[model samples]
Target: MDVQEAVFLALDLTGTFVFAVSGVLLAARRGFDITGGLVLGLMTGIGGGMIRDVLLDRVPNALGQPIYLAPPLIATLLIYLIGKHVSRARIWIVTFDAIGLAIFSVTGTTIALGAEANYPAALLMGALTACGGGLMRDAVASEDPAIFIGTDLYLIPALFGAGLTILAEVTGLLGGVVSLVIAAAAFGFRMLAWKLQWRVPQPMRQWSYRETGRRMKKLPSVFRKPD
Candidate 1:
């Protein structure tokens, strides 16, 4: 494959694998059956690309590449087999999701640029690609999507990564290594956000509508690291 093609393939497959891993783990944790796990994995693996492709007026890659479907199925089986035995499976799920977010964001940005989108549009695409699958999965699983609710610093890291990649391209520094590094930096940024508890900026005004303390405790725990 040409260099650009090779880079795209690597990032695409890696992101698919990681996202599938997270989806399967979460499905299993939520008491889903094997079929549910597989279905969830498939959706979480390709939902973002589906959105990206539709917006770009292209056929979604998930429909064309049967081989690309393998990762989610494999991930589902593996996580189902071994994930139940682990005490800290939640950590693994989140870690994989974070990695998936970082890689997919860059791939989405690059793909949008290929379609002649401006930098801002490309950055938004990147963030969408990073969060789209998870949002879909959350909706299906009946959990609130943390990205929109500001449960973590998810969207910022994605946009920053996409913006950095575009900046590199503008400065004539784009390459496979640079892309990979930027992706890693995005991952680190996410980890740091989790560590430091960085929150999305909200309006300074307090807007408490009711006594949410009792109701908040009843919400599902599927949000985060695994968001």
Candidate 2:
């Protein structure tokens, strides 16, 4: 592979490795056994890429390259061995996960673009590659997926990274540096959200029962209305 391809492959593998580590750590925190950690880690590491490949009508990279499976298993083994001493594993889950997510966003978008996908499809594949694995991991673990179930900055930053990749690819400018910047920005955004405990706004009014009752009192009761 040329330098660009080599660089992207390294980034993709790094993402897989870190995502596996995050999954294993989370499994440890959830009281899962080593085997469970292994399962979750493997799922989290390669699930997104597999899903993206299938959606794109291509062979899953992990399937063809069995070596890709090693990272998650190795990560699980490491976490199981030293998880107790690493009291900060729980907190580090977010950090590792964020980094993995950012890298996956860039890698996925790059792959999709290389496959001749349009910008929109490339953007979507980027998100899938960043999130599909986590979704699978959470479902297997019987927990909520952090990206969609909460106001976490995960999906937003991933989308931004994907969008940036598309823009750079289209313009043929900063093609090499774009992925790096996108990954870094995405990581920073995710870390800041976690640090600030930021949340996405929803349609929730957040009125307490007392407030609801007060508001109700202002309206005429049906009993007092003409029957």
TM-score of each: 0.87, 0.87
- For each candidate, the alpha-carbon lDDT, in order, equals 0.84, 0.85
Model 2, 7-124: lDDT tens per residue? 8878888899999998998899889999889989999999999999988888888998887898898898888888889888757888888988999999998888888888899999
* Candidate 1 lDDT score relative to the true structure: 0.84
**What CA RMSD would you report for each candidate?**
7.5, 5.1
The candidate that achieves the highest TM-score relative to the unseen native structure: 2
Q: Where is model 1 poorest over a 10-residue stretch in terms of lDDT?
A: 203-212
How many clashing pairs does model 1 include?
A: 0
Q: Which stretches of model 2 miss by more than 4 angstroms?
A: 204-227
For model 2, name the residue pairs that clash: none
